[model samples]
Target: MTSTVLTFAVSALTFVLVSLTPGDAARAVLGRDATPEQYRQLRAQLGLDEPLAVQYWHWLVRAVHGDLGTALSTGQPVLRTLEQRLGPSLSLITGALVVSALLGVGLGVLSAVRGGAVGRALDLLSMLGLALPSFWLGLVLVAAFAVALPIFPASGYVPLTDSPWEWLRSLALPVLTLGIGGSATIAKQTRDAMLDEMGRDYIVLLRARGLPERSIVLRHALKNAAVPVVTVLGLLFVGLLSGSVLAETVYVVPGLGSTAVTATQAHDIPLIQGVALCFTVIVITVNLLVELLYGRLDPRSRG
Candidate 1:
């Protein structure tokens, strides 16, 4: 319920901010030499001459019906454009999430279980992962894998319909770029959670009962430690799904993030609003899923 309200609030906020932002979308489209009269006519045609509240209300109504208005640049339906981009974005995000979850949880578990040089090294790597900027990491990956070794293709998106293998190959660098950053965050969270769980009295009790360390850690500690990690994973999943603009831009993928960037730069209000709303919906859905997971993780949270 709160997430739904937040979605609406964010959508309204996005609309207001975009509307208040300086620059005339009409003029941007018409370019310089467009006189005041030309701007007036264009604004009226685009319904921009209406009061801001009226404009927002109109947008809200259409938005509720899944009609996000038409893009001024392409004259295509905004929803249609988003629909076209959704698949590639989902594929990239899914791949990244899987990689992050596996690497992060595995490394974190190992780090917790082994408290020596190996653990220290994994901890250092996690720190580096957090410190590294995503865009720079993306560039480095491109240089090493795409340019130096000529492994994965440097840029461009391929549809699954064309070739499943090619589609997967195209996303390698972008996935790594997002996954590496996400894994760092997840790893840190997982490590902390595991450490906390390990120090609990119950863990000591279980150890005293002669249960093997592996069994105790895997069956007991991991389940309890997973709650917070699951929360972070939900957030990371949303971030990836909404499209990592930096990663997508670098990879030249026609994902939601890239489309939003182009629309915002072009001052395509309808397109921008549509994209922002879609992101809000995705976030709300993910958050709700996280809450559900919380109930499962800690039965006390159910009430």
Candidate 2:
């Protein structure tokens, strides 16, 4: 309970600091040529010129009533905008999580069990994935598969309602971009954890008892190995949140990353605040899920 409260307080503080960023959307969109009266008027209109505490209170009240207000730049309802775009981002995250968990854990187990050339190759592949930046990789993919070969569209988004297949195609490049690094990281964590677990006396005893090698290594061993893997998954939530910026822009996907960067450039306070809070909530929620996962995986953690 104490930890959860602390997390909420920390998140609130982070949101406050983010909201206090200098200059409003008007100032950013319009140059310094805008007069002082204009600035004051805009501030009053935004209610941003007020004390930080006051603005926070107003936001809290409005949020409780389920009104997030319109974005200053576009005049779009902030909540509606988030709802419109969340599907793409959510889909990408889901795919990355599922694929990374499977490939990483499977490859990691294979590498750990076989200390030969195949294992060496997997290690090198993992390093390559980690070293490669996601955005850069996205561009390379676009060039090869989209532009040069014309296999996919160069850049654009199609609404799922309009064409689900097209929307899926649009997401392919970004998924590979985020997934490459995420999956590689997962594989490495899994391999290291599994190897460490395998060396334990209990695992050795299971192997000695003439248990099926595959069953003992996978069913029994992977459960124990998940402790570190779950930790990585919690940390991966941050990567999924921030790393989407590049991929979103590269693919022109309507994810939070694109909107957040646009808000920053436009100096839209509410939009930026929305982005920050969204990511903060995601991270905290993922961490809580991981805590629950810990209890599920290791009964001792329930204590």
Candidate 3:
């Protein structure tokens, strides 16, 4: 019920905001120097001449039936446009999540287990990761790896079907750009959780029972600490979705983020609304999945 309300609210708000932005959809499509008659005809055909409430009502009806309308610029169905762009975005997001989880969990566990200089170093690195902007970091990576070293392509995506290896190579920099900050957050959370779990009486009981230190830390303490870390990961997924905009733009990834920029530039309301709606759905779905996962990890959360 809550999810349904949020979905409707976000969709309605997106529609209102996009409608309020100053631009004539017909004029944007027809361009300057179009005859007044041509503009009027196009406006009527596109239903732009109708009252705002009427326009929204019409759109809402069609959207309920899964018709997102046509993009003013491309004349293509918005759902089709989104389908074409969703793949690259998902690839970028999935790759970044993997990178963050492995790096963050590894660094965090190591820091907690071997405190002192290592822990301090991890702290400094996390701070740097959080401080640096993804786009700026992307540029630095491009210069070093793509320009200076010529190890990876600077900006562009390769379809996985064409060559799986090349596709992964292309996404490398963008993934790193989005993942670095996420890793920092996860690392901090994991470290704190691990520290707290290790200090608990249960951990002392396990040690007294002659459990191996490594087993106690990895199997017992880490499991108990996972609830919080998992929560951070769920939030990170949403952040990564938004952060992909900058990463995609910097790397020319041809994802929904880039398409959204193009749509906004051309005042493509249907396309813009479609993108916004798609993102909202994805975020809400991810959050729900996270909640389920959280309940699984910590059964107490189910209550």
Model 3 accuracy (lDDT, Cα): 0.90
TM-score for each candidate, following the candidate numbering? 0.93, 0.88, 0.96
Ranked by lDDT, the better of candidates 1 and 3 is 3
Model 1 agreement with the true structure over 197-240: per-residue lDDT tens digits: 99999999999999999999999999999999998899889877
lDDT of 2 at 105: 77
lDDT preference between candidates 2 and 3, better one: 3
Task: List, residue by residue over 190-246, the lDDT tens digit for candidate 3.
Answer: 999999998999999999999999999999999989989988998898888888888
Task: Please report the candidate that would top TM-score against the real structure.
Answer: 3
Q: List the residue pairs that clash in candidate 3.
A: none
C-alpha RMSD by candidate, in order: 1.9, 2.6, 1.2
- Please provide, for model 2 over 1-303, each residue's C-alpha lDDT reduced to its tens digit, 9 standing for 90 to 100: 755575446546855766666656667655799998888788788887888788767776676577767788888988888887677777777667766777777788888988699999998888888898777788898899997898787677777788999977877777777887888899899999989988999988998898998898888888899999989977886778777787788778888889988887777766766666666667777887999999999999999
Residue 272 in candidate 2, Cα distance off native in Å: 1.6
- On TM-score, who's better, 1 or 3? 3
What does the lDDT read for residue 303 in candidate 2? 98
User: In candidate 3, where is summed lDDT lowest over 10 consecutive residues?
Assistant: 16-25
**Top-down TM-score ranking:** 3, 1, 2
Clashing pairs in 1: none
